[model samples]
Target: MENNRVKKQPPKKNLWKPEEDLILKKYVEAHGEGNWATVSQKSGLKRGGKSCRLRWKNYLRPNIKRGRMSQEEEDLIIRMHKLLGNRWSLIAGRLPGRTDNEVKNYWNTHLNKISPLGKRKHVDSNDQNNTNSTETTNKKSKIHTYPVISIDAQKNPTKESNGKKEEGSTSLLNPLMTDTKSFSYDTESPFIATNTSTFFFDDEPLITYMDSFALFEGFGYTTGENYAELGMQLVSP
Candidate 1:
């Protein structure tokens, strides 16, 4: 007595070539689609029916989109994904010139970063926590090291006579400043740089800086508390 068992063969998975593609395309065009079983035997291709179907449907389709997905397409995919929940075939059917596999692949690789659906709330919470921590740290590390300045713009320093003014002095504080325009006072400008080399008051060089509007640096008008700390006096003519 002789007993025998037959082993089932696995499906063909040979890579498709250009000539094979041409042959398959022509055959499909001639005979029409929807019959993948006899594609290998009838069309003389070494690839299995499943492989032929995939190649034609996914890549070789005439109306398929070839370039990168447009913003409109991406938005649509996201919307559809939210509604349909990974039903790629249904989603692809809604979009013109797009295939199921292409949509599936795009969603798997690209859609996760942008999709609003299935997003966790913990991410936002973590961001808020970090922001609060940063704010607290900044408040703790704050310092008040701003420079103090006093402004008293006397037109003629010789009359006030704070410094010694010798008679017939070549470069004296008689007129105080030669380049009055260098002082360039304007309420609109932040600060004015002045050339104070016009005098050596009692044989000492004097440099002047004035931004009387807010003469102090780091005096940002950010808070009501900061505004309250500021003071100024108006001079009468």
Candidate 2:
């Protein structure tokens, strides 16, 4: 059996007037955009409902975060794409207020600018040790400062007696570490993986915060010196 599914295309002259925008926005909000034919008929736009839907999604959504991605953001998308492949929707989740289309377009456009050396390195194959790329030195400096926050409880050992820390408790101190070489997790620090080459922490809170975690282990540490013992027990196995 032959299957025929025609691809939809945006109109050649895709100029959107204020009145048309209002009508489409109103209709989409009132009834949503599933049946495009009905949307065109009811919304009274000169263009197809699919066009309206595309415009609304690709541009007019209230949550859409417009503007060129900062260098750090560009690096993040590159890094995440390596981990997620073409799963733009999943990548979009990490970047609030940005659509998958925006990420996709940005990835397509700016990616070439970042990698002018002519090869599109598969994100998965990129070596973490090789920080040098086609990107400018200024952009590279921005990437070095981007914060990587994770919720994994194993890497960061808490000295507090509580077994689990709530979400939103960690601060973004540095870019999240990734590498082509796989590594195992062996630690008591909920924030640090065993093979991590560098550790960044907020000096003011880490001691007290880790102490609070010690309470979870049925330990009563009366002094800061005891944290080593707690850390040893937490990572003993």
Candidate 3:
């Protein structure tokens, strides 16, 4: 008897084209990345979401700042790689503008090559540990050496002076006194006390002397045929 089981075929590669990369770079330069599906459709590229995103992040976008790494940058990469352990996304965050794929490719191509040159006498836990102990050993062995620089760290050196000036400008230290003529500062108004003290509340809607005076003096709404009614209609619910 013959067997009829079939082997599964591999998926087709989503190769990045030069023109596609150029279009992605241009569009991203104009409108920043992240909306990959919409971007691909707009750019007329046949690439999928993941592929388009990877292409733009890893290859395109200006100020990429690739090539030979500085000693400080390299040190950060080494420390991050050890701490994060092949977590390209996490490691890439430590180095601005650098992609996970770029970091991974650099680690595989460059770092691995140079790692042997500066190899210490100590055994690499990754190589020495058994499969079960590997994860635990690797976790404890790798240590982060550098202090991660942040936005606050790299903020304006004169920020303290600016902040001090800003704090001084606010009424935090010195309190303000409000005038009572145009503005009222009373905790209990005379009108409020008069209303609560007297049991007689006018059924004809008693207008305050100040309010009537304000209307008479044209400081408030002028008496008209339908000014109040018109005003009421204009106000939203």
Candidate 4:
């Protein structure tokens, strides 16, 4: 049996109207925020609950710090990002009124260009170093296990001519997986194992984010003069 996997396409973005925003804002104001499904239903807005929640939280929500991220916020984001890579919600938790989406967008737009990980490199066997590690997240005391990216391939990759595959070859059209390659993950992170010499996924999402995660024994940032400990972080205002 040939099993064909369907790729999930992102939902089409529908712009929110002024009236819709007004209704969502008023409803949230009157009833506090929670139960997004109820808000989507009771508000009579033809939008998904996720959409309604994001709209309210990102735009309609009160006390959202907007217009120009402060120097302090940028520094905090950088420090926090160093401690926690691509975990936007955890990074945003340190910043008041800043949602994960907003933080991610800002990083992708502005900070990414300036950071070391932003530098583009040719997708080759060397990139395999970045993709070949299992991530472990330890928050509080509980240990969360991430998918182990296990790929066994040499520096040199085999090339395919005329884009032709053998009759008994796999269904996946990607020629990058010429050798033994299997990329599967149960978690949300969509990783594909490939011989990096020929091709690979975008470095920003999987390669840099995963490879850039350089953590010590615990959470905190350090410099020659000052070592800021984790106890001082997320201090309530």
The candidate that achieves the highest TM-score relative to the unseen native structure: 4
Q: Which is the leading candidate under lDDT?
A: 4
Assess each prediction's global lDDT (C-alpha) against the native.
0.48, 0.48, 0.44, 0.51
lDDT of 2 by residue, 1-237 (tens): 365776666677769888888888888888865787678877678887678778887777676788877765676577555433454554454465667888877876677446544245443345454333322224233222212232233334342455343222232111223421111222223222122322222222433333223232222332324433322122111
Error of 1 at 122 (Å): 21
Per-residue CA lDDT of model 3 for 165-199, tens digit only, reads: 11111010101213111211121111111112111
Q: List the residue pairs that clash in candidate 4.
A: none
Error of 3 at 81 (Å): 2.3
Per-model TM against the reference? 0.43, 0.43, 0.42, 0.52
| Deviating ranges (above 4 Å) for candidate 1 | 1-14, 115-237
Kindly report which residue stretches of model 4 are placed more than 4 angstroms away from their true locations once superposed: 1-12, 119-126, 129-237
Error of 1 at 61 (Å): 2.5
Order of quality (TM-score) = 4, 2, 1, 3
**Which whole-number lDDT from 0 to 100 does residue 51 have in model 4?**
94
Total backbone collisions, model 4 = 0
